[model samples]
Each structure stands twice: as structure tokens, then as C-alpha cells.
Target: MSREESAAQARLREAAAARIRAARPELADAYDLASAEGLLAVRARIAEDTAAPEHLAAVVIGRFDLASWARATCEFALGLDPEQAAAWRRSFTRTVFLAGNPDNLRERFSFAHFADDGSAAWTDPGPAADSAGLRRLLKLFDGPRPLPVRADTVVEIPPRAGRRPDRPPVHRELHIAASGCRVSDALVHLNHLLAEAVLDGLIRPGDTLTIRHAPRLTGLTDRFAALRVDTDPTLPGRLRAAAGLTEEALLVPHHRP
Candidate 1:
């Protein structure tokens, strides 16, 4: 590609990176962003080997919308059946992101994340003349059972009145089961939904967020812990830096920062 073409492609990546940094700057230090970059590099290598336009486009789209991929991961998990979800909870450990560059236009890329066991294996049919590389990733389980999520329904558990109710707020438990879905998938789905809700301004920074579920079979007490991220005003700036964006664009208020 010509130097001018490369420069144009870089500009497009910068723009997309800007959007992501603005949305979640605190994750700049997280390995997921770096892992995503590595995947993008791999896609580029595949593209160079094959010279496939369609493959390049697919790769770039996957990388450019990294957040969307994470969201998709949750959606996929949430749709699993109860039996499958429970099995996945015990078997899955790592969360992976896959990406590619489709058209070779400015190194554009896209990615999606999946939860899998550490030993899960994948095989790729090296770059096709018309494709990037045929990927055989770990297959995900089927969608969750047909259980409706009632957004307006609030299942209340009354606070215990005996203790120092005034000193420490009474804690009540809410039992929320996935709408006829697998337990593992429901947790992932809920995680992504909550993440998106926070990103979209629907869930405020300090608002109390809770996950209610039956402890008997959910196995969520441990899996759900990793999703906790304290939102700081400076987090967006950090995320921008992680994406190789200039820190000036973060624009967080000083008091909050």
C-alpha cells in the first residue's frame, strides 16, 4: 500500500480509538486492550499472507468495535440453557478476544470475546486467497432457556430490623434467575448488560449495582467478583492512553478526577 493510504488508515483507527477511550478510560491498564492489539497484529499477518479484501474488512470491523464484542460475549453466555450454563461455569476460565483486518484499509480491525477453559484449542486454515484465515474457535454452547427478563419487576427482600439498622444499612438478598437459561450464560450476559449500562449513562458511577441469584447452583459468588471496577473520573483518560490515544482527549472534570 502507498504511504498516503497508510496514513489515511491510521486516521480512521485513531477516530475509533477515541470513541472507545471516551467510553471507558479506566481500563487503560487492563490486559484486554493489549490482548486485542495482539489479535489485530495477527490478523494483519494473515492478511499480508493471503491478500483477501473480505478477510481484512471482517478483521477490522471486529477490532474497531472491541466493546461490542465483549457485549456479544455476555449475550452469548446469557442465552445458554441451565444445564449448559452450570457446566460452563465449572469448565470455562479464560476470556478471549478474536479480531481481523478485512479490507487492508488503514489496518482497520474488530474483535469478539469468549469465555473458555484454559486448554481450549483452535485451528485456523492459514490465509485463503479470498479469505483472511479460516478460524475454528472453541464452539460456544446453545442459548439460554426461554426466560423473559422483566425489567420493571422488582423482587423486594425486606431488610432485617433487629440489628443496628441505622448504623449499617440492612442488607437484603434478591434471588434473580436467568429467564430459563443456563447459569453460566446468565452471569456473562448480565455482566455485559451491566457494563453497557454503565458505559451508556443508564447506570451512574456511584449507583448501587447488585446481582441476586440462588447460591445453591449459580457458582457466581466467585466468577462475578472480577467485574467490579470502581469508576473514577480519570478512568476514561487511562483507557485512551491504553488505546494509544493522546491523553488530552480524556476531558474529565478536575473535581471528579
Candidate 2:
């Protein structure tokens, strides 16, 4: 591209970034991170021998949305906490924003995260990409929504009669089976199973499920895991058969006491 053309593209990139900030307001940091010059340096480092960053960045950039992704992580805590949410927004922005940059398209350009525990982080592809990436990431965030079958469904355990409202209930045991399944896919499958049981009337409103052995639903939501997952994979099948349940019941918030 010519200098004039490059300048024009630069201006357009700035304008596009401006539009996104105005539109999302919530994603302001993400926009800034994507447009920041510092990301250029991060992209440069990936031009070394590491291919993991490039492929991983592509996988994430193709499916990440800062707003929704943070919510998915924080929702495990309940709703959005502005401070924690801001931290997450910064995390994803700093990590994947530039990994998806048009200029950072070198074969060596890849991705990495700052987390001590080494979890994956991604970004929504830029607005100039026609929002295809944004739409895809948003879809992942949209669900495990409410099951349509309503039965005054207070599936959660009842609050202690004299307990203080400030005190949250203790977490119930969660059984996590070992599997090669991706966390996101597993969540969808489990949600469907739960929905099936509820629809079949096998699960009733106000019912609290204490599944002794079950497969843990994995995903961003699992970060704020309410269920204590079991490491043993064999037990879940046994428990499912013993209970005559074709699906593993998740002790989600709905089942929280």
C-alpha cells in the first residue's frame, strides 16, 4: 500500500475504532487496546519461532467478544462486577486484540496470555471484518439461557429461615468426568440434558439436584465454578445408570441452596 493509501487506511481504522467505542461504551478499553501502538510490539515477538501464538490467536480472534466473554467469566460470580469486569476486559484486549490485527498476519504471528494459570484468552475480530467474528463470539455468550418451561421454577434450595441474606450459600459437590471434550461444547450438551429432564417432568420446580457423580460442564463459566468437580470419569456413568438418568445433572445456580 502507498503512503497516502496507508494514511487513509489509518484514518479509517481510527474512525472505525471510534465508532465501536461509541456503540459499545462497555468495550471502550477493548477498542483502545486493539488500536494501541503497544500491541505492535507484542505482535512482533510472535514473529519468532512460536507457531502456538499464531494458531491460538486465530482460533480465539475468530470467536472472541470482549463484552460477552468477560460476562461469561463473571456470570459465574452472578452478574457483572464493574471492577472485575474491567480487569477481564483489559486482559482480553491486551492479549488478543493485536493478535488479530491485519498488520500482524505474519506466519509467526501468534498468541499468549498473562495469566499465571495459563488459560486461553481471545478477542473479537475488528469491526472492518464486517462483524462476522463479533457475531460468532456473541452467539457463544447468548446461551445456556433460561429453559422455556416455567413452573414458578425455584429450582434452587430454599434459603435458611433465619440466615443473613449477605451470606451466600455453601457450594454443593460437583462431579467432573475426564474427557477430551471442549468446555463450550460440553456446556451446550449438558444444558440440553437438563432442559430435557425439566421438560420431561423428571425434574420439577423447586427441586434441588445433588448429583453424586456427573460430568463437569466446562467453559468460561467454569472459572467461577460453583460445582466441585470429581476427577474420576468412571463414576459419572455409574451414577447416571444407577439413577436411571441419561444426562448428567449440573448443580448450577438453579440448584444452589
Candidate 3:
């Protein structure tokens, strides 16, 4: 790439980052939009995949909408193609995971896995992960039959004095099956469901969440035999810590619903 072309691409990336920051201010502290690494990583992927970085970048940035861009970027990063694993990892390093109330979370916060290499794996709220995430979940299974997994929690949404009247707390439950998946995967899946419930306004901070797995699953009872809110102050932290994290991973607080 020529010096002028490189500079132009950098300018476009800065503009794109600004656009994203404007749309989601809460991410200002979460991601370093000024960094050139993310743009380089993304551009590399585009170049490798299509060998037309400038054209693809123009098309994606020409008429950008936050939602569509987020969806496309995430889907591309999570593509099942084995050959793109390195590219996907690079893309993920620039992505942020958004979880909480879908309305606010999608429009606000960002999440990422802090890596030892100083890169973060980020994901934004896009398509529901139920389908694709579940497909990935299936890969973790080890046995023939699916093991039952359930997570329940109660949320107390305190009323605003003048805005609304006091209401009772509500209970929420999420159920899934793991066919001999590792205890860790099962816990991660439960955490995913819990995050979804939080997005749906069914779970909230300070709420106690309980995970129930089939007794037959070895080592599960030992790890999360009687997990509760008192034991784990932050439910989302579990998802952040479960996997895809390195020894140097730093835990950042997620938005509360």
C-alpha cells in the first residue's frame, strides 16, 4: 500500500471508530478506539479473504448503520471456517461483548477478554447467540445424551419514588441440556443464559442465581455444588472468566440491568 493509501485507510478507521464511539459512549473507557492495531487486524482479514481491502472497507463504511455493521462484523469473526481461525482471533481481539438490557447494552456498553499479549477479545450485541452459540455449545458435548442444565434467579427492581410504585421481585429460570459436555462448558452455557435473562430484564445485580446440573455429571457438583449469589458477587464475571481467557486476563465490571 502507498503512503497516501495507508494514511487514507487510517483516516477511514478513525472515522469509523468515531462513529462507533458516538453511537455508544459507554464504550469510551472499554475500548481504545484510537489504536491502529484493530483497524490493521480487520484490514488484514479483508485483504486475505477478498484481496480487495479498499473496496470492502468502502462498501462497509460508505453507508454504515451501527446494527448492521455490528452484525456483519461479528458473524464474520465467528464464521465456522477453520482456515480463518487466526483472522477470527485477530478480529475478536478488537471486538467487545455487550450484555445487559438489550436496549441499553446494545446502544451502550462493550465487553472484551483482556489478553496477555495486550490485545482484547471484544464482542458487541448483535444477533442472538442462541443459534450459533448453541452450535458451538454442541461441540463441547462429550457423551451421547444431553445433560440437563438449569439456572434460576430472582430480581428485585427497586421502584423510583416518583416514577413508579413499588413492585414485587420476580423469579426467572433458564434451562438447557449438555450431552456430556465438560463442567466448564456447562457453566459457561448457564452463564450465557443468565446474561440473556439480564438482557431481557429478568436478572439484575445483587440477585442470587442458582445453577442445577444433572447429578450424574462428574466433577460438576464439586465445582458448583451449591453456587449462589453470596458465593459469586458478579454473575457475568463467570462468563468472562470461564474460557477464552489467559492467565493475565483482567476482569472488568459489566453493565447492570
Choose the strongest candidate by TM-score: 3
What does candidate 3's lDDT look like per residue over 156-202, in tens digits? 22233454322233322222233344443443344333332333233
Q: Output the better candidate (1/2) by TM-score.
A: 2
Per-residue error (Å), model 2, residue 248: 14
Off by over 4 Å in 3: 1-167, 172-179, 215-257
TM-scores of all candidate predictions against the true structure:
0.21, 0.22, 0.23
lDDT of 1 at 63: 30
Q: Model 2 TM-score?
A: 0.22
Model 1 misses residue 19 by how many Å?
Answer: 20
What residue pairs clash in candidate 3, if any at all? 95-122, 95-123, 96-122, 96-123, 97-111, 97-123, 147-178
User: How does model 3 score by TM-score?
Assistant: 0.23
Error of 1 at 120 (Å): 12
lDDT for each of the candidates? 0.30, 0.30, 0.30
lDDT of 1 by residue, 1-257 (tens): 46754443344344333333443343333423333363245335434643322211111122322233333333334334454333223222122223333233223222222223211111111112322332232223333454334342222122334533223222122233433345334434444334333233333221222334331212222222122221113333111111110111112333954
Q: Ten residues in a row with the worst lDDT in model 2?
A: 237-246
Query: Which structure is stronger by TM-score: 1 or 3?
Result: 3
lDDT by residue (1-257, candidate 2, tens digit) is 46754453344334334323422345455324244342333334334534321211222323333223322222222222444334333222121222233223323333222211122233222222333453343333322323222122122433335545433333322232324334443333333233223323334333343333233332212222122111224542111111112222444465656
